[model samples]
Target: MDMKKMAGDKAAEYVKDGMVVGLGTGSTAYHMVNAIGERVKNGLKIQAIPTSKATEAQARELGIPLLTIDEVDHVDLDIDGVDEIDPQFNAIKGGGGALYREKVVATLAKEVIWIMDESKLVDHIGAFHLPVEIAQYGSKQAMARMEECGWKPVLRVRDGKTFVTDNGNYIADLHLGAGFDIEDVREKLGTIVGVLEHGLFLNMCKRMIVGTSSEGVRVIENPSK
Candidate 1:
């Protein structure tokens, strides 16, 4: 079986009839979206709250009903993808630049699930540079501030232009090096002006469906969930 598909299908099994779901972004989540689309066609009634414009478009194309954050009381389940996940199940998401919205939807959901291949699981999260969403207005100042904090932030650019997120915010990919204290960085980033949200998702996921082409799929549970 395809690893991404295996992981995604594993997560789709958790979606019940008529559940209000939080749809996520990225490649692994893309597989889940397609799987959910198939379920929708077979008479599954689900309202999806998409975390990014790209995700919203995919879900819309798949005929999944979408709802704004204000439209629903709360999300029943959220299936997202992570950039990196640690032993404690703490994860770093926002690789698709949807950290702000993803975090919002995940928090509102009763159960949050992340789908990924085996490579995403890590001993620690710092290997992949973390994403920090920020306003474009004072991004230079923000980057300078991060540099002062020793994070070595870099602007995420696209086609010679600064990459822009669905929410019209800019992204700063922080290179914090190995053995860095993620919690301290999270706290410090929160205190910085112009910082909207970072990719460091601490204790948010209830379950992770990790897959590999050789091993099929397996589920890992977070104690908090």
Candidate 2:
């Protein structure tokens, strides 16, 4: 089986009937949503909460049941994609501005299972431009502070204008040098006044389904102890 499809298939097994689940964003998550739709057609009876408007549209087209965050006490599972993931299960996400919702859904779920391809797995996560969503006002101040913290911050603009998130925020691409201290940088950036949320997801995932080009799909779960 193709690795990406295999990863999707593996992720689908974690979704059970009658569960309120978080539907993730990005290509891998797109595949997962399709697999879930198939199961739903077969009477999975799951309630899906999409992390982005794009995802919500897709889910609706597939006839997957939808729910709001306040409608459920907690979600049974959350399966999403990451830009890059380190051995510690720390990840950089939200390249598509779905980070805030994704984080909310993941934290609200009993289990978070991040699915990704082998190319996305990394020994370190900072090399890829880290996405930082922030309030519109005081953005320049935030950018300068990030530079002082050793990140080269660039405002992400689209078609000659600032790229706006689904929630109407801006994304600053923070370019950190290779092998930077992932945990320390995450903490320091998180403290900045204008910072809304950074791409770094630390110790938030309970499990991961990693797809490899040759190895098929492999599952890594946090120790039960």
Candidate 3:
């Protein structure tokens, strides 16, 4: 089976009837939504909270039922994609700028599962420039602060215009050194006035399903038990 599709399909199996689910963004997540749509068509009843406006639009078109956060106390599961994952299951996410909602859903859900192709697994989380969504008003100040933390911060732009998030905020790409202290940096960024949320997801995922060309599918549960 194709790695991307297999990752998505396997994650879809975690969804059950009458559950409030969190729908994630990106290509791998798009495949998950497609699989869920098939189950929905066959009467797998559930409400979905989409992580982005783009995903909401896609879910609507596919006829997957959607609900607001206010309408649900807790989500049964959230399946998302990560840019990279380490041995400890720490992740770098939000390449699509939906970190705010993704984090909200992941924290609010009972279980969070990340689906990714084998190529995304890394020894450390810094290989991909972490994306941080920030408020437009204090971005300049925030950028300076980020640089003080040893990250080369740059405004993210796509097709000549800034890549605004679904929440209408700007994104900054941060380059950090390998073996950098992620927990320390995450706490530091959390105190920053302008940041909405950074792409570094720590201690959130309960399980990760990684798909590979040769291995097919690999499931990893958190080892901190």
Best by lDDT: 1
User: Of models 2 and 3, which has the larger lDDT?
Assistant: 3
Off by over 4 Å in 3: none
How far off is residue 187 in model 1, in Å? Answer: 1.1
Give the per-residue lDDT of model 2 (tens digit) for 1-225. Answer: 666667777999999888889999988899999999999988889899999999999999999999987788899989999988888887889888788888889889888888888888889887788899988899889988988987889999888999988888889998885578877888898789999988878878888898887777999887741
Pairs with steric clashes in candidate 1: none
Better of 1 and 3 by lDDT: 1
Please provide, for model 1 over 1-225, each residue's C-alpha lDDT reduced to its tens digit, 9 standing for 90 to 100: 778888988898899988999999989999999999999999998889999889999999999999999898799999999999888888888878899999999889999998999999889888888999999999889999999998888999889999999889999999876557987998899899999999988888888999986667989888776
The local distance difference test score of each candidate is: 0.90, 0.87, 0.89
Model 1: CA > 4 A from native:
none
Residue 177, candidate 1: Cα error in Å is 2.4
Locate the minimum summed-lDDT window of 10 residues in model 1. 174-183
| Highest TM-score against the true fold, candidate | 1
How well does each candidate superpose onto the true structure, as a TM-score?
0.97, 0.94, 0.96
* Model 2, total clashes: 0
